[model samples]
Target: MKNTFEELKIAKSILKSLDDIGFKVPTPIQQKAIPKINSGGNLVGIAQTGTGKTAAYLLPLLTRLQKPEGNDPRVVILVPTRELAIQVGEDIAELTTYSELRHAAVFGGIGWTKHAELVEPGIDIIVATPGRLWDLYQEGVLRLKKVKHLVIDEADRMLDMGFMPQLKQLQEIIPARRQNLLFSATFSPAIEKLAEEFLDFYDKLEVAPSATTVSQVTQTAYKVPNYRTKLNLIRYLLEDEEKFTRVVIFVKTKEHAEGVFKVIQRKAEGEKRILHSNKAQNTRINAIQAFKSGDVRILITTDVSARGMDVSMVSHVINFDLPRDYDDYVHRIGRTARAGNKGDAITLIDPADEWHWKNILKLIRKDIELLPLPEEVEVLETEFGENQDQLREIDRQRKIDDPTFQGAFHQKKRKGSNKRSFDDKFSRSKERQKRKKRRKL
Candidate 1:
């Protein structure tokens, strides 16, 4: 087993770039993957986020990237989101700093005219999202016949976001002879099925068990009463500026992302930013860049949007809301505890999140430590409106899982309401007849 980057037979220029970036040792993923990737074969890498999975493939590919020949890309990397495309493009630039490799990243939000100009001359490598890539290909701006390498990064995430159709389309369009590499955090049945359909015969590389989180992260969950109380807890925790210096708070929805940011804006005492689908592309990129440069202490984001961000040395990852999708918990926590650095993951769970919380425990195959609420963190009473909203969502989820499941928020009807229920059909008819008789008199 090669233990260091030097033992992996990387090119001098790439090695020089890595050394300049202070990458002394190869991570577990890199150690297990680089050798095979350096040689020629289709590969499937099963590893979580922050496992240096990007470098595992990028290094070897960068070494293989020769000078551009024609008006076409030699390699195409498909990511799940635009944020990831930008981050991967940045990584490629850093990795090829000492080399002469040319790359471009094309995603939505920016005008296609700009990307059209970018790929007009030619590109060595292209990192893009499925929709944007398809759009460019349809516009005759992207040529894949010259593509010698095809990489589907964050395969699980791509499939979750319904990119399988686009992937199948690209698979049919790109040259049939290129090497394929699919990287994923977990190999669930669905992901495995995707691998079987999408990838040719390939070597498998796994650094850890599926759904395994970073060992360096200390995991803890706080049982809060409601969303307002979760904010109170966040306020209490952020008071320790030294401990919570660099944080990524993960929420489930755009509304929650905005809500959390607003509260922390007035209450917390540090620079903060929010990233969500509703935000403009430049805005999201700027927020992430600011957080990466240490200009901001906190970044609140949704799971899908944060998948591509690779900020190092994150002090902590706080789950402002437990993910309904259990696998996201792993991705969220993986943001911290990176590169053998110890960090913490704090999860706030409300009554509505109990079902999702249990699923998370089952996914990780263990129970997390429960942290008692601090004295300063006052648990606020859940307001009636908020409680009903939560109950409605919970009931909706339960019905999907179990059709017979009856929940607390079951629909009820008032007698005087205009809309009549099946049980009130006769009463409504009688009321109408009484009104008609009075009118006739």
Candidate 2:
């Protein structure tokens, strides 16, 4: 049975806020985690992104904050990145409009003075990135002793990016008797082990497993030979005229993201926006806002924007480069096809990424249909051996390196003396010539 938002037993002010926002029913994550949080028990919620995990924690925490019995900053949510910090802050702000809760978000890439100015006189809630929160705590601008609720969002991403140390430091300072909530899209073994330290007899809630993808997203892939060919394929897809109207492209690194953006802009008509780690905080925020407002039709981003972004109108998602972590694929594609809308997720696979390509299939546990590249897109690859004898020889070499070889083959030794040298001769000659010229001078 579907649970209604009013049945969650939240405070009247928060209920009115939910009505104002037209939140009729609780999402899966919200339905599970809200009850656990309201019970005053620590919880570990393993849910997918865009599953309303933010509201799962926010609604209950807001209700507790308005208890009027005790005061001091009652809630602290530690996120993985600055962008996520700002995103969560905005989501929480939207829900807290009708209440008297004072909240502030602290993150890097902004002035220290600004954060200090915001932290004064004790806020009811704080959303912060780990590093920036650590800095503020060290400077004595915030007090943790009175904190009643401690929430850690994106736990796996936090551990992946080496925020565990900072998170541990925070645990040492905050009050021991606080409600704890840990939310993550995917949880690794390391994170599962770490949960033992923070949560107390916690309720483990998982709406979906680690490898699940949204049902509304249609996943497809294209096999190309190299990066250049993949770029051409993206241009072709964008110019298809009927397939896409608004699209978000995900790449692996910041440099590749910008390069893809530049290539698309050079080939594509109309305006395009790029979102990566290099841009200023305001610029990144503006690009997201523009994309959400329908002013910008295309957004090129890295894994920085992969988690917890709730833009509902994206029509297409392009995986320009597959993420190393397969779980990220699910989050990247969830950007589109939201709110019962249909969307498509397309991936460009190059020859060099054969290993990474298999990982996606393994994660999805389903074979992805490979679409033939458009005729205008050229695939460049060197054919090793097409003839019978050459192909046999190549197979022989493959057996020697293959993991299943098992000492199966024996070959004759070479006749000549082997020159197994570590150093390059050309580099040695260049260095010697430069030294001799210096001596002559």
Candidate 3:
């Protein structure tokens, strides 16, 4: 196996950029993928988010496109979200520093005219979300005829976000003879179907199994009673500012993200920001920048910021709520322990979340260490409504597992109750009618 980027025979200019960025060695995915991509064939890569998958494809594609060619973009990279588009654009800007390659990162949440202006000047590469890309193509501002390289990053996420139609349309628009590259963190049947549709006799590579967590990250879970207790625990953990330097807290919903942010904002040791789908594009970008630059110590967000975030120094990842999708747990924790840095992933599992957490364990095929709550952290009583919600969720899960299981929340019915009630009402009606008739006679 090749150990260094030099052994991989990357261009000197790109190597210099990598060196400047403090990357001396090629990750496993990078090592395996660069060669296959350089061979000029369609390829599919299965690897986790933090395993240097972006650069694996970018390095070779940039190397091949040594200089700018035509007005239309030669390379089109489609990502699932605006955040990922921005991140990929930044990477392209950084990697192409020594060379002359014009690129644009276009996504929704702003005017399409602005993106049109960016691409109108002539671009060699374009990183975009599917919706924005389709809009640009329809407006006659972007042309796909010159595209030689087509990349779909985070394919699983695209499916999750329902971008399959856009992807199919993109395939129809782009040139048929281009090199296709699809990289995803997990390989599912749906992904296989997508590959069948997108790639033409492509080579498939898997650096690691699907849904595998990063080995560098230490996994631990705390069995908390409810939301209030989780907040208290978070407060207690944040007290150690030195150990918990940079953290990303993942919540399941925007409401919960706001709640976590409010609590952390008041008592946590350092600055914090919240991110979700509802936040404005600029606000989300600024929050991500602050978190990346170490200006903010904590970022409380939904799964919106989970995939394609390339922060290397995150000290810990806190799962404030279990993700509804078991596969997302891997992506959430992957935000930490990036670029070969060791980090920790801590999950606060309430009673209702236990079943989901167990399912996550089964998916990842590993056991996370369970820890008792800290003595300083107070475990508040679970609220009545919250308790009932938990119970209801538990019942729902039980019913799913055992079709015949009658849960506590399930309503009970006595044997022959309906029949007996109907019979009693009929007898009373007949007796009243007979009494009326006798009186009339």
On lDDT, the stronger of 2 and 3 is 3
The sequence of per-residue lDDT tens digits that candidate 1 reaches over residues 1-441 is 998777898888989998899999999999989888878888999999988999999988887875556779999999999989999999999988888878999898887889988888888999999988988999998888899899999998998899989999988999999898999999899888888886769888889989988888899999998989999899889989989999999998999988888888978878999888888888989999999899999999998889788888899999998887788888899999887788999999887788788888888887799989999988789999988888888898799899988888767676668866777888888899999999999
RMSD of each: 4.3, 8.1, 1.9
Model 3: lowest-lDDT 10 consecutive positions: 414-423
Task: Give candidate 3 misplaced runs (Cα > 4 Å).
Answer: 414-416, 420-427, 433-441
Candidate order by TM-score, highest to lowest? 3, 1, 2
RMSD after Cα superposition, model 3: 1.9
Instruction: Name the lDDT value of residue 269 in candidate 2.
Output: 62
TM-score computed on alpha carbons, candidate 3:
0.96
Of 1 and 2, the candidate ahead on TM-score is 1
Query: Which candidate, 1 or 2, would have the higher lDDT against the true structure?
Result: 1
Question: Each candidate's TM vs. the true structure?
Answer: 0.90, 0.85, 0.96
TM-score of candidate 1 versus the correct structure, residues matched by position: 0.90
| Cα distance off (Å), candidate 3, residue 96 | 0.8
Best lDDT among the predictions, by candidate number: 3
Candidate 3 per-residue C-alpha lDDT over 158-190 given as tens digits, one digit per residue, 9 for 90 to 100: 999899888888889999999999999899899
